[model samples]
Target chain A: MATSIRGRGGIGPALPLLTPAYLWLVVAIFLPLSAMALFSFMTELPMSGRDWSLTLEHYAAFFSSGLYVTLLWASIRLGLEVTLWCAIIGFPAAYVLARVLKGRAREAIFLLVILPFWSNGLVRIFSWAMVLREGGLLDTTLNAILPFRIDIDLMYSYPAVIIGLVHSYVPYMVLTCYLTLQAIDNALIEAARSLGASRLQTLRRVVLPLAMPGLLAGSVLIFVPVVGSFMEPRILGGRTGTFYGTVIEDQFVAVFNWPLGAALSFILLAVVLVILSLSAPILRRVQ
Target chain B: MTNLLGKLAAQAVLLSVCTVSVHAAELHVLNWKGYGADEPWAVEAFEKATGHKVVNDFFNSEQEMLTKLRTNPGLYDVVMINAAFTGQALAESLIQPIDTAKIPNYADISGEKANSPMLNQDGKVYGVPWVWGLTAIAVNDKSFETSPTSISVMWDEAHKGRVVIRDDAVEAIQFGAIASGQNINDIKDMDAVKEKLTSLMPQIRTFWSSENDWNQMVASNQIDIGTYWSGSADRAKTQFNLPVSLVIPEEGAVAWLDAFSIPVGSDNVEGAEAFINYMIDPEFYVEWVTKVGAPVSANEKAVAALPEDAFNRAVMGDPKVADRIQFQAPITDEQRKEYLAIWQELKVGAQ
Candidate 1:
């Protein structure tokens, strides 16, 4: 590890090479984050020409108001639901691609799975509306074939939002899990089989543990954006779509309350950090 | 080869210089989708008539437009704002008074429409009146045996699970206020409005944000009844062959007027004024209303020029219908906060 840190030379020689990337991060990430933090403490946007003072009223409002808390909880639950669904659906598909499938068919199928990522995300979510609404393509198609007629009015519901989010984000899980699963040696699995270990036992005890990093990476990737997503929920979930992200969006776009939005965003960031810290121990152990 | 390359470079320099000068003269407008100015050939005509090119941006809500105008001053030369927002715009000085002298077509605007309290505030014309419409009930005729003419039709049990409403806080609260026999402009009791909205919550299939989404839902038979703009309901009926029709309910509908204004810090005021003048022209107004299917214009000549049956079907044509409309008034900051809070609570309570 010491030699690894030392690299070809020492820290001094590497410093110059790393400067550009670190500088870019400072300019792009750190600056905006710092500005957002500062803005969170303001009473109003200074540019709005309102008589303003630095106040904690914005943060206090978050704690004082039950609505914000409820929405935040709803958003957290949505993230958890979407991330769980992505994992449940994605892991098996990745396993099949990495282990069972091979060559040209695997390549083509993998491309097909991730082809959704190439299209505009908003367009894809809107397309789901065409299929999910009452008397929509799904309803019409199912009614045409099914023995009994049933209404399939799913649009503007919670399930619609989840479906849209999962569709948009499942590709991330599959791609990550596939990379890690493919790296696992075939000999290890064969050895486990030779030792009379069941496939389920090997999967639970061996494959899962090794693939934990990819799973965690995918979870984090999916959860963070999902928590902050408002557009998908708005387009799909309708009135039932109101979440912490949408509230923040309303503050900025609808209410013109940038300071309050910044405050809410900061609080969300805090919650996310806490979640990441809590999960870090298990993730490190698996690594 | 070197001589040829040098000549090409010289030509490139000349071309870029011309482009830069033309770009500098461009007028940037922030408007709503299909709000009179960007129909089919509006922008092209404007560009051809004036040497200045027109760049357009769009916003769905008045609040969104306000935010854009507030944050990025001078970015937009012309903006189409609602009557409800003109007061705040004036107070904030986000927009400036139009020079009626420069816009000769301002004479064509009917006295009654031009003198609306929204367009002229404190004796200053802050906005050029454009299009006006009513927020009314859109119901599929096939859904009801008899035409439902009341706003209470939304809360009717028969329409439950098949009704949609606009996802706007103020408008939603207004509906509740109107239903409960309270003044929508000045709410004496917030709890009453809350109770009214909450009671109707179960009947609503969803609250839609966009006119397009609401219209499509109604057109496709996904929703049977909803509250939507007059123009969109008309479009969905005529264009999409939907059985949907708009009716001004007995409880009255909210009236909104969109007008053109030059932003405070705009350098291209002349270009913006020219555009506004062009918009109110009788021929342009007729063409705009025809393409857009909106029933009202500030210009009297345009209304007269419309087909014979158009007025009979429009809210503005009937004085009784027009008088009943509750024109959206600008809310105070405290009131705005209250309205939004009430809306947020309504959402949470429903969940």
Candidate 2:
């Protein structure tokens, strides 16, 4: 259709069709981002009756306070830890679904793996709170069958945050890895095996390298959002949940510091872009 | 037959147009859920009698409300602002002073509740006190032998890892200020306040931001004692069947009053005042106040109308409850920034 349309009018005819979508993107995405950037430089919101002035103080405030840097580092570490766990857990499950599992069982299990995506993320995180709190499902159930009692107070702890985040994001990893793994030809694996490559050797040399793109894609998907997430950490980490994202959340809703929040958000955006650019070489290899 | 049907349709449309013209005013109310007497019957009756439509929008917190009010001027006719922050709203010109002439029921407000510092700012009335409650301690009866006598119990080593403090930056820092025996409204010593707040970090099982989180934590036995709102504790005990008892510790507790304020650029000033008047109507306000578990009815008639036992349970009945309460005062901007900074440091240090 594109070729026929081009043959008719050298792309001018298609411009009208594409303008609406591009215009929407520019209006919806670009305009708000630009406004946020502008707001970050302002001393006060114009809506507040205060006389406004452009200043670098909002950005400078980040550097002046060591606390913001520490929180940002903490959020980065959280994203890394969560992405690592997702990869570790999801890659194996994806491997099983793509290779070891077969037919109706595989399909049913695949659906089960992705089921978390269908429910409300907030409600799902809340449900994890129910299961992880002390004397909750995990503790009571373990005590019910076991010979001895054990206490489990995972809620409001670091592990609880990790568990909640991994549960929320692992599906992306599994879905991505499965898509890549399924596309791998069976004959190539057979040839590797016939050539006397051990199962572990074939997996390490062929499977992993072949699957790197999906893993990288999944990592980026999980890492970016997790770094900016406040809700999960607030609900699950409790006392331990103060990260860059939560602080930014506080600045807007709790502190009523819009300029500072915008500055922090813009900084996060820059960091994400840099990270993406750094990973672009490997992402290119995946294609 | 077609001409007759057409004539009937025209008459029906004319009747609807006449009805629409009668109810020409709309008051956009921005408040927390159930801030007003929003019962269907009360709303319907109010609409019918006043010929004004009340459209309500909700926000979760004071800061959230301020953000919305600032960003969208003229979007709201009336707003429910925490009494403490009414000054902030006025300073920012987000709200305008109330004309008591427009709200004749203003006379119905009790003198003391009317004199609440939050309702009047810079010698002008910017807000009308609506719902007021105590910020006190909620103790699990199963854990405490007797009612915990003091706020010091919150920092007692025995209760470490079993106490839930509010996640609010200002409140958390103020708790520390109070712990250090500093006047909560006047904290001149920042370093000392920070040290005092950091000292309590170890005792916090978690810092809860939402009432639901606090409720679940207390009711599920995850927290033994907590810095909780009076209404929340009451519901946990009565509704959730939790073994929780409310107390105002010896060190005093933070109390808050949420009030109605007209936004700066309200489109329907008369309609807004009418709605505010309707909110304090003894019959409607009583049910509304009871439903929300708010302890105080700012209206004198509503207070008189409450059952004797009900009034006793309400914070208003306990005369000493007022003596024990330190109403939250609007903090200076510098203090606000310092409080958040210190709270952040405490949070990070605790981890």
Candidate 3:
């Protein structure tokens, strides 16, 4: 009756607890992806929904088709710009949250930071369009008094999409970076200050290096989704230079080629994985 | 022998009468939002007309409607798709051959310049004609001191950055094509199209993607001149106190017709045909066309019913204006590909 396996060496309790997460991950994530991978390999009817023999032509078309290449590259470039801008803006904001404000004030400011993101992405983009368009708020009210135009042509350019994307995802960056910067000991900053370092030097020498983990974390979180976004570019960037996400959407909806859509999705998944792989070592170094 | 033959003939007549008395059927219908938004009314109409219960749903776009049809043959009885989808839909055999004889009201169909298949290649009458429209250039008369007659002013370089057009691929491309004096349909030389489009891209303040986008652009005066559809301008002029005009350009416009077609699906073929016939009725066609801010095409009676102002503004049977307007056409897959490719180069060059 005495199953006294509470002994440390038995190792039986840990396996079962860990097994469920692995099982859950496989069932929820990997299994559906496996089915999609199977479908993507099969040939699709030109416009007759889905039918025919299995083939690799869709994959070939994705790479060999020049349109796909331009779009994919444009999306990558847009994500990089958003990520870079988010880091620049978010890091300082995050550092301030960690270092300057406290208690209700900090929480209130944090809520304000994320409150705008709670509304729909589509609505926010439209409002931004209202500001950015000519004779718009930025132009009529702001640029009228300025030396130059607000560059109305830029509303549908890569820059507009980037600005919209950066605005949308900056909160994610701030929160992640704030969490990391918070984990850094205030004692270290005090020590740096005690050693006769200025506030700027304390930030650079003590706070910045310690906060790298959160910065990298924020970058991955923002960049991956940014790369996948179609609506931002389609609405703000005018659908002329479609991102990778829009291409996948078109294959399924507009073109009625589900297989090609699936293949493109998997390629994007591969790209995400490669990015993760490349970033992991640098992330580890940050840690 | 005469008595026996008389009894057999009487029995046959009785059998035919029995079969006609009790049959029940349902029809599947697809349309845009707010169109079949009044489904109960349509259901009542269907019951009154054909003694069949109508099951109707709304599809946002032609592609979704056709996708549903392709996946499930004999599942949907009827669909209302836009004009731009018809060419490819016809070529792909996604649309069925309709028995035009059943739709007695087909002869009354107007907007012949836009909706009628006689104007296009492979002109098999698949889609029964529905509403062809006047969702065209709307101007704020206050914004323009003089009455304007051209779509060119929407892209004038002097107006420079104040210009606007829709963010849609085909519509915006058409605006550029019109500006460049290029054929909207046959734009194979992409370099020329790109160069032309790139020129316009700078002039445009916004390439509006949705109905809301165009409305906001005009209402706020974010854009002074733009190519916009009518339903939106009608709302702004009537409701928002925004003084805007929906113009017919001197050069003409590319217009559309949303029509009813039975996609390759449907269990109730007979019922679908009856439903299409029901929509074409003068009473049903008139309310829908006017309510949805569209101009009616199917009924002579409906055009006659419109108030004097709406009629004079071309909702009435104006053959001359209809003849002159350039109708929207469905591009081939090859053409669609080419158009988008050039559009990309245009965006990059604009930057």
Candidate 4:
């Protein structure tokens, strides 16, 4: 351990490199987390909103809790759905960009894809609201064609949330896949063609595999945050259904149960870790 | 499985850092959105009275404010909570009881608004009475073609798909109980409420959860009538040229009082109290009343000083709607559970 600490260079040379990160982790992440964990093992005094006894009641409550589990499952399901849809839709657009667009034109197209991503998340969601509401853009289009009135409701439903998530994440997936696809040597494809390999076969055998790393990274970036999200579900998800975000929010807000909220949050973190660990082997094979 | 992560760049660890700060010259307050703007006259007066930086943050709901408190125990020194939530927050010892002696300004507030049976419990005050409003029948006169005076109008089949009620299950259930001619206040028997409201749920156009949602629905003329606060109703009428009118149904309405209090974990207790004291001054109270036009229980001098139109808008309508508004009292735990259970059923049953 001492050797490991002293390591690749003299201690004096390495100390500056370690100091800032250590200070940051301690002040910003670890300290709050430690307080949260400590509180989870304690009992809050009723009406005080302050902890009283150092017990495991919160953990006990969480382990046997049906609400938390169901909400967790719902959140995971939504995350996976978002990830699958982003890839399916993003793949075709990314292919056209990577294989077709070149040089300055490609750069312009890339900026166009990221432009909407720069807008505030809330602004983008509400802009969709104007299109999806009862008398909104889609409604206006549908009304102009029909002979009579047909009221079709789409707002405040799961499909609305799905659309919002897909819209938000498609850009991210495209950028990742585009970068990976751009790095492929044109000579490799020219050689494959000369060696009697078909276009489709070359894509399947070479290009797709090369781009897998980008796909994996983008999926992680989108999935992890979306799984624990509250705003998207609250704004776009139908009223009849909710996710883990709502449950965690309620524990803290309605019930004043911070310890439970912290415990539930960590539980979500563990589940995300499990998912990533399980997928690592597949990611490696693609690489 | 391999698609789990899409490669882009270095992993970004988002650190949403929060720190507790204390300042003698500045005071931070958490209040309802749009309630903090000062009256032109009051602004000039308050600056002269106290040399402190007064700032405010708006929360969407009482629940949102409480969530901020839970995340960082001492993040906010003062928060606005309704009576029902305040009792629980006080009981949890999450909030500090108000010592009126420290706030001489509080003494100037009228006994009716300050020491009302609704604002006072067990002789220990935990909040300063701020504003009062009620959830009543907000009707689109264009739909009814007649003035509305009862909650039963929301149940009419003719208005199906046009009726809008608060998305709050508890409030909706209480309306169901009242419309069905049962006790609206003590919701001990939820079965009766569910039996009555389950049939009415389909009639609802949308269970609006926020002012924005309800406003948009009303603006588009999708929903014609519903229960809403006077402030929201007035905004819809004025801004969108909506034909909506707030009515105190013959069955009466549930009155609400939102008050400000210091959290028990407050780092700057003295600053918070001084801020709270500043809010009740006749100058600030009059300004708040003029801007918000919500019913306020304040010193007789403050109430007397407010524009008559503003005071009238808060209490009875210009023509006097009703005098029988009932406050939602802090019920027993059994009552709370009953409300929650009935609420769950209503939530599931609402389309």
Candidate 5:
């Protein structure tokens, strides 16, 4: 359809069709981002007749404070950990769904894989709280079945935060990997195995390399949001929940420092762009 | 055809009578969810009596409330603001001075609360005192051999890894200030406050930001003792049946009052005042306190009317405890940043 349209009007005819999407991007993405950038340099929000002036102090504050840098590092580490766990847990599930499962069973299991997305995020986080808290379902069930009592309290800890995030994001990894894994020709795997290659070797040499794009896509999908996540950490990590995202949230909501919040957010955006650019080479090579 | 015309005439007459009797105006109220203003029965009663429908919008934080007031001028007729923020609202002219004459129940409000400087600017009232409560310690009865009386119990080595506090910078700083015997409104030494809070790092199991979080931690037996709101403690005990006890420490507790204010560009001032009046009415207060847990009503008459066994009365009745209450004062923007900086540092240090 695009070629036919271009054959008639040399792209001018498509401008009307494309304008809406581009306009939407400019309005929804660029406009608010530009506004945030402008606010980041402001002394205060120019509203309600409050005195305001342009200033670099918010960015200066971010640079001067070691605490923000440390928290940003912590957040990055959290993102990496959560992404790694998601890949580890999700890849096997995706493999089963794509290679092992067949017919109605695959569809049903796929439905179940995406089931967490159907429920409210807060409700899901709270449900995890019930299961992870001390003397909670996990603890009582373990103690009830085991010969000896063992405590299994994991709530409000770093592990709990990781578990919650991994639970929330693992589906993205599964969905992405399943799509790519399904597209790979099974004949290649069979041929590798029919030759001298063993099953592990077939998987590592044939299947894994084929699935790299999906894995990278899944990693990017999971990593970006986890780094900025506040609710999961606040609800699950508790005392250890404070992160770069939560601090920025505090500046806006608790501290009423929007200029600083904007600055922090803009910095996070820059960091994410840098990381994405750094990873682009690897993604291109894998593809 | 004759019967249809007769029915249409009858319907028209009824509609006219209804319109004449009811002067209904929708009042948009801003408050914390589940707080007094949004009580279903009370709103129903107010609507029935005054023929004005109440629509409630909630904010999770005081800053969000201020933002709503600032951004959406003429949208909200009535807003519930903490007294500490009332001065800021007045300064920004986000809220207009409430005429006490419009709310007859204003006379029944306790003079101390009504005359609080936080609600007044240039001798004009910007907010009408509504409800008040404390940020103090709550103890799990099962974990304690005896009641703990001092705020220092938070730092007690025995309860290490089982204590929690709200995850708010200002509240945490004020808590530290109180523990260090510095006035909440005026802390001279920042380092001392930082030291006191840093010392508390070992004792904290987690930090709770909401009533639900606090209740869940206590219910699951995750926390033994922590800083909690007085009103929430009442709910945990009476409603949820959690074995929690509220303790006012010897070092005193932080108190905050929520007040009803008219936004500057309110389209329905009469309706707003009527809603505020109904909120402070003794009858409404009695039902709200009995059916649902709440901060103590600012109206002395409402407090007096509570049953002797009412949870609020049992917890807040003592005049001696009142003497030790340190009402939260207005904090400057700079002060908030400093407190948040110290708090962020402390949280980072904990990790």
Candidate 6:
């Protein structure tokens, strides 16, 4: 298949076809990243005739202060927790959709899975606040059904942040896992059953390994953004929301220290890259 | 064919001339979204009276505002700047000094506000005083038996896990400084301020960033008390129907004044000045304050024109309250960094 396509032009026709996408990547992604990298080494923004010189102080500031490193670890932990929650909640839903449900019902449930993407993210977060705050929907409903009074004030706490993030990102896990799970042959599962494997063992040894790529893909998609999210934590985490992303946000909008913000941003990018590289080996094996 | 071409040429010439005239009469304004400058009626009135159209752009924060002015020079004719940042704008030459004599309404501006050091340097007025407001303590009326008068209520153990404050480094540090009896602008004892802020952390339920956040938290009964803007507090009470009371604590409230200035390289300087004159006029101020809950107007006559029980007049009109008000001073970049560092450390420690 590769030789048939290439035999016509010997990479000549493909160059023009691929140029626009590569150009876009260079213009949209690389240029800004390169600018940010340069900016991360500056004393001040090289605008408005302000006297500025090349400096390593901004990078040094990050290392000298323990606050940034601590917050970065906190954000990483938040990313991991949210990713795990998303996997737990989404995998089963995907399984039911891919295996148990039939044509029209499967389509309806699939639509429901992706429904959260239709609305604005901010609106969804605020809706959770409505449900999570004291005297909110969750609290009112619980108290009404039960004989005794109970409080369910989860707003502005760490758990609330995690819940909001997981709610926002679970759709990615569902979509990715559903595709892979649906591709697993019924014959293979039947063969496992005929070989005297239990339902749990069949899922553990056969189904899980087959769905690894999709699970890993979904985890990566959810993990990266969750690590750098400022708005979700700010709205739901309350005082506890001061993670690495929020601190970087302050450096730009609140503190007007763009150089330092760029430095911090570059550091975050490097850390994310390292994480991705570490997972590349496992991802390659699954593929 | 010649006649048909002649008619087309004539129409094209007339269209180009009209376009040039309309473009010359347009003024680009930079301000906060929905803050008096872009009010539909006010814009209509200004355009009708001056024969110049107004176009507005918004910035969410003072830092973003500076960045816009810095990056997009000559794009904006007039800008609304907080007085605390006017000095920085002047130092960077982002905004040119206004010719107050060109603005007819400049005479009616209150002497204290017009001559404020933040807006003036070396006897030249850089920013024309427009409006002012207070960052004071606001409490859910049901939570307090009697109106709390001191800022200490934020640190009161009874309100622990029910108290909130703005998540701003400058405001938080200044609030802490005031609570610790240090000057808001010049804090000689950083250790004391840090101690006071660190102690207040446990009492904080969450930090509110935007006015919407404050209203949602307060309305839902998640927070009983917190630091809030006086103008927003008024709106929360009157518009949102929230039972919020704005308090001028014994230690005085943090005050901020917003001003209008012409940016450097503005093509329509005359139109910008006229627009600013309209903005500060008693007619505009009175209509804006009465119709939309607004910050205190810089025009004294505008304040007097309000009904006796008007929110701004009732709360900020008193001379005693005015005397105690600690208007925000220009924050140096170094000082800002230091304050932010302290604020970040405090938040991290709390977490």
Give the B-chain TM-score of model 1. 0.89
List the global CA lDDT of all models: 0.84, 0.83, 0.70, 0.70, 0.91, 0.91
The alpha-carbon deviation from the true structure for residue A198 of candidate 5, after best TM-score superposition, in angstroms, is: 2.0
Candidate 4, residue A62: how far the Cα is off, in Å: 5.4
Q: Check candidate 2 and list the clashing pairs.
A: none
Cα lDDT tens digits, model 4, B1-351, are 344443322222222111222145455567776564333454445445665455566676565776666665766777878876787666656677788888878877657668765456688788887656677878877776777777778778888767766645457767776666665676566677677777776776555677777777767767778888876675566545667787778887777777778887676677677767776667776655455444544455666666676533445533344356666666554454345445544544452
lDDT of 6: 0.91
Candidate 6, residues A1-287, lDDT tens digits: the string is 67976888687768888999999999999999899899999898888777888999988998997989999999999999999999999999999999999999999998998899998999999999899998999999999999998888998899999999999999999999999999999999999999999999999989999998889999999999999999899889987988999999999889889899999998998999999999898789876
Please give the C-alpha DockQ score of model 6.
Answer: 0.79
Q: Taking the candidates in order, what DockQ does each have?
A: 0.46, 0.65, 0.22, 0.13, 0.80, 0.79
lDDT of 4 by residue, A2-111 (tens): 68767856687677988999999999999988887776676662332443787766666556646567667878988999999999988777888999988998889888
Which wins on TM-score, candidate 4 or candidate 6? 6
lDDT per residue (tens digit) for residues A127-147 in model 3: 777777656667677666788
- Residue lDDT tens for model 5, A1-287: 87898689798877898899999999999999899899999998988888899999999998897999999999999999999999999999999999999999999999999999999999999899899987889998999999997888898889999999999999999999999999999899889988989989988989999999999999999999999988898888877888999889988889889899999998988998899999898789877
What residue pairs clash in candidate 3, if any at all? B74-B265, B74-B266, B75-B266, B135-B230, B138-B245, B138-B246, B139-B245, B167-B208
Give per-residue CA lDDT, model 5, range B1-351, as digits (tens). Answer: 999999999999999988755534878999999887887899899999988878899999998898889899999999999999988888888899888998999999999899998898787999999999999999999899899999998899988899998899999999998999999999998789999999999899998888888887778777889999988888788678898999999899999999999998888899999999999999998888777767799998999899887767765968888889899999998888988899989998997
Sort by DockQ, top down from the best: 5, 6, 2, 1, 3, 4
Worst 10 residues of 2 chain B by lDDT: B308-317
Candidate 1 docking class: acceptable
Grade the docking of candidate 2: medium
User: Candidate 2 regions off by >4 Å?
Assistant: A1-20, A279-287, B1-18, B21-25, B40-51, B101-104, B116-118, B121-124, B265-267, B289-292, B309-319
The Cα RMSD across the true interface for model 2 is 1.4
Candidate with better TM-score, 3 vs 6: 6
Candidate 5 regions exceeding 4 Å error are: A1-9, B1-24, B309-311
Model 1, B1-351: lDDT tens per residue?
999999999999999999987977789889887666777687787788887788889987777888789989988988988877888888888998888899988888878768988778778899888877888787887787877888888888988878887877788888788777777787788789888889888887888888678777766777888888887776666556778778789888888777888999998888888888888787876666566555477777767777768742344678899768887777776677678878987877776
RMSD of each predicted structure = 3.9, 3.3, 7.9, 11.6, 2.3, 2.6
- Model 5 scores what on Cα lDDT? 0.91
